[model samples]
Target: MLLEVKDLHASIGGKEILKGLSLTIKAGEVHAIMGPNGSGKSTLAQILAGREGYEVTAGSVRYNGVNLLDLEPEGRAQAGLFLGFQYPVEIPGVNNVYLLKAALNARQKAAGKPEIDAVSFMRLVKEKAALMEMDQSFLSRSVNEGFSGGEKKRNEIFQMAVLEPTLAILDETDSGLDIDALKVVANGVNLQRRDDRSVLLITHYQRLLDYIEPDYVHVLANGKIIHSGDKSLALQLEAEGYDALMAKAAG
Candidate 1:
């Protein structure tokens, strides 16, 4: 198992958001989490990425057999864990490629590896940019400073591609994208999928699954996963909505 969350209970500002949530993701598997608003999907992703402001009240999260909750956010990133935020932040003066290079070097340094050379780094970035169908000029601009919603989301995936994280948690990456942009982002994700990488996609809609099919689809309700099935489950939820299946789970 790449990640294991057992009976996780977490809260923010004394209010519980994740209650008895459990999940496991093995290497190379893609899992999609779907739920209504306020179901704690993003909370789960945030906690896994070692975000602050959320307290773990009970239970445990183990990543690659390590006590994941004990690691700091930067530690988690260096350990090959990546989180793509629902809203990508804008850094006004930091060049996009510069940030990615620094991040990559940091991770490499943590692993006792040499920093990637300039030539190799540029080659890799350009290759990934082409994969995301991004203009080369965008790489030189400040990170997400003036990017559209779709462009920001695609840039997050582009960062994921370059970093080549072992486990990626994408929180609503497909939320505001049009069909064309969605396909571009999905394609970028698909091309990066490998036997050594795992992806956890938190989404509210089923349309994303149409492009990047997951091995498992999980329904989260009231802070816990109420049900799980294959890709067909997403189609079911799309067709019938959450009420019917959630009702069945309640029974």
Candidate 2:
């Protein structure tokens, strides 16, 4: 298994958000979790990324057969665990290119590799930026500051492209994006697909799945996975909605 989340339970401010959510992702698979608001999808992503403030009351999360929940946030990144945020934050006064270089170096150092020289790193970034249809000017601008919603989401995908994580969790990445921007972000994600990489997408709408088709689809409700099936389940949910899915699961 590339990622194993077994009987995971998490809470925040004394409120339980995840209730024994178990999921396993093998190499080269794309798994998606779809749910309505307050279904604990984002919480699962945050806990996996080692975000603080959430208490892991129970469960074991192993990545590559090693304990993952014990690692720090940066450690998780170095270990190739990536989280694409629903809302990419703005960091004023931080140049995007410089910030990305620092991030890449950190990962490289963790892997016992020498830091990439400026020329080589820039060349790589330019190639990826072109692939994502990002303007060169955005590279010199402050990180996400004054960027439109679509731009921020695109930047998140761009960061994902640069980092090249082993397992990626995209939490509502399709939110707030128009059709054109959504396609761009989806294309960026699609281009990253590989046999050794695994992706977990948490989304509410089925539209995004149309572009980045997942191998499996799971339905999360009230902090638990109520149903699991193939990709066609997303289309079913889109047509019938969560209420019907919940009813089917209830039966």
**Which candidate tops lDDT?**
1
Per-model CA lDDT versus the true structure = 0.95, 0.94
Question: What are the TM-scores, per candidate, against the unseen true structure?
Answer: 0.98, 0.98
**With candidate 1 superimposed using the best TM-score fit, by how many Å does residue 19's alpha carbon deviate from the native?**
0.6
Q: Check candidate 2 and list the clashing pairs.
A: none
How well does model 2 score by local distance difference test?
Answer: 0.94
Clash tally for model 1: 0
Candidate 2, residue 141: lDDT: 94
TM-score of 2: 0.98
